[model samples]
Target: MKVSPDGQPTADVIARVKDIPLYREAVARGHFPVLEKAEIARGFPDNWMTPALAAALDAGEAEFVLSTGTNHARMQLIRPPYFLLKSYYRLWSTHPDIKETWEAGCRRVSLTTVLATEHVARVNAKKRGEEPRPDPRPADRRLDARTFYLNTRLDPALWERADVERMLAEMAEARQAHPQGWYHLDCSGYHLAHLLQKINKWGLWDAFSPPASIIHAYEFTPVNVRRYLQQHFACPIIDLFGSTELGYLFYSDRRGRYHPYLEDMSVELAPVTEGSGLFHLIVTSVRNPHMPLVRYRSGDCARTLDGTPDPAKIKQFSGREKELLESPSGPVAQGDLDALVGSVSPHVFVHQLRVLSPAEAVLAYTTFDGRPLAPRQVAALGHGVRELTGRRCVLDHRDHIAIGKSGKYAWLARDGK
Candidate 1:
């Protein structure tokens, strides 16, 4: 069966696969070898390289482009055509509870870092005692209008209290200009939350208008920060889950439950061990025509709350396969520890958790750039870990918890020689 250039499978193709003996046989074996065969035939491009994506690029239908290196290294992805993104817009605008607080007709104002690339260049220029050159206007400015390239390597010292206050003032000005306006923020969750913490710590919250909705799309949001934003704004916080290779696949409802959006994608959970409940995510997606992926190992672990494939019942998108800690007792996901720490103290930003002994662990975290954690807060964090994991952990405040060169935080680290 062949897929169309636009990623739509033809009627003949659908009919052929509807009763194909190979598909039936594969399903019976709890696998999809035919899809794997097709992927292998196509050289197994990432799942995001679908036929629709190629068609969109070929026809110049994409609007915004985003780059992500979170998993398989840096690569660009085009946002779906306006019509497709509008579907997402509609979902938010028409949501019953959300629509009441957020005005539907107001145009969105995007608040992001200024001169994102120059931020890095300025840092480099300072070392050489030279001024950074102004960015040249591209010949095709329209093509670059919606493109935002953030230099993720900026020094934390630059984003001080004054810089945070200036951003809040801008947000306030935007709100005053359009009283009913909605804000559409785009940035890494960690960066945005860090900025907000500075604002709060500096007493700037009352000066700015609360955003109608907050969308954190670029990276995984630490659970505590999500709760804080929701509580502070009293508005819905939306999270988009997908990769550059795959278009947006899931979105959280107002209640923060993820619902799959891919009608052509099916998910299966194969237990890592008998009765473990933890399982590997096996996906068979027919969405990408140019490069289809069948029975693909997404390298993520999850467990169904009710032990079934009902999308609504999927309780947790646990952790990356490689990040799982295999101890003598069993496998423990990093996400579990993240939740435990966050629950203990919302102010704590744990960058690494090291197990020092079977019953003891050490937490290394940065308290807003050497701002010491109160003794009671540190104790509360330790107590929370003991309550959650039954492991007594010593909380240590550090000058800084190093982000990986890749700009990701590793939550857990095993003791090494």
Candidate 2:
């Protein structure tokens, strides 16, 4: 529970670190420094594999897994199987806005990337190791007793009418599976927005049931997209902030107010650059018993309400540290551009900032209604972009902005890098 002046853990963190073999040399060297992914990858399992940890692995109490590599490279991790799910369930059951539905024992329908579904399938197949089971059904991709996967493809934008209908039918089946006839919906915000668009276009609303609560935990949700989801579902729509390694670290309520969900963890914010509002997320957590992390840089960037490193005042999970762009003005993050676009118009769906040169960039976007922005709104957004990046901004309207191969969207793009 004790934390340092900067929100990093104090005695509690040291106690956890003192017992981990991986931290012995770092601890002996003097001060416990920030731990990077490179340092973690350097030694692999041997670094943290104590006798107890190895025994746990053998006993299937813990498992070795790789991160999704969405934000950065795939990170090797060790923790109990379903560690992330347990964390997510805890948050869902305790979050004020969603507790009642959770208490009602609602089923879970997950609509995220097909990669996630495939990863689970691969893991399960490898674990089974040739044990025969019933043939897998194309429509039935259940992750657990309560959670069902609905996305069978990578690109939501490319989902044909048949695909949309199948997902809706699966959702209806998921709802009926629970005795209470209720289910909590979990999804990537972008995926949900795309699904909504498809549903509206195809008039498939009747086939889909309104979830008791909705949590978008997979990736960053644009302000406009969040607004778009709000306009359709009357249920509580929340955004969860975390990673595959950390689980649900924080979550936003129905009102879009953030609350920390750090049970056995602490956080610190170190500025990306001196005098810059942007800060790198540094966390000290003992949540994962086999792989406790101290002063770990999560590769995420954020901004506090007053531009200070008060963890409670964390205003935005702006973007990844690696993706932050150096602008003539200073530094520009995905969130900064999002704020400008959202302010200009809520119709903007997805946007990508392409830096052409040091002094020029193009903002390509798609609208919810598939129409270009008004001339005045376009001019306003262009002006804001120019001021933020200190570049001549060009607004380009597009019918679609492609998702990455990983089934996520990159907000910033620069040639060759």
Best by TM-score: 2
Per-candidate clash tally: 4, 0
Task: Give per-model TM-scores.
Answer: 0.67, 0.95
As a whole number from 0 to 100, the lDDT of residue 126 in candidate 1 is 58
lDDT of 2 by residue, 89-133 (tens): 899999999999889988888999888877666656666784323
Residue 317 in model 1: shift from native, Å?
2.4
lDDT digits (tens) for residues 246-305 of candidate 1:
545567776778776664565656675666566776665555433334555666677677
Give lDDT: candidate 2, residue 293.
86
Worst lDDT run of 10 residues, candidate 2, spans 131-140
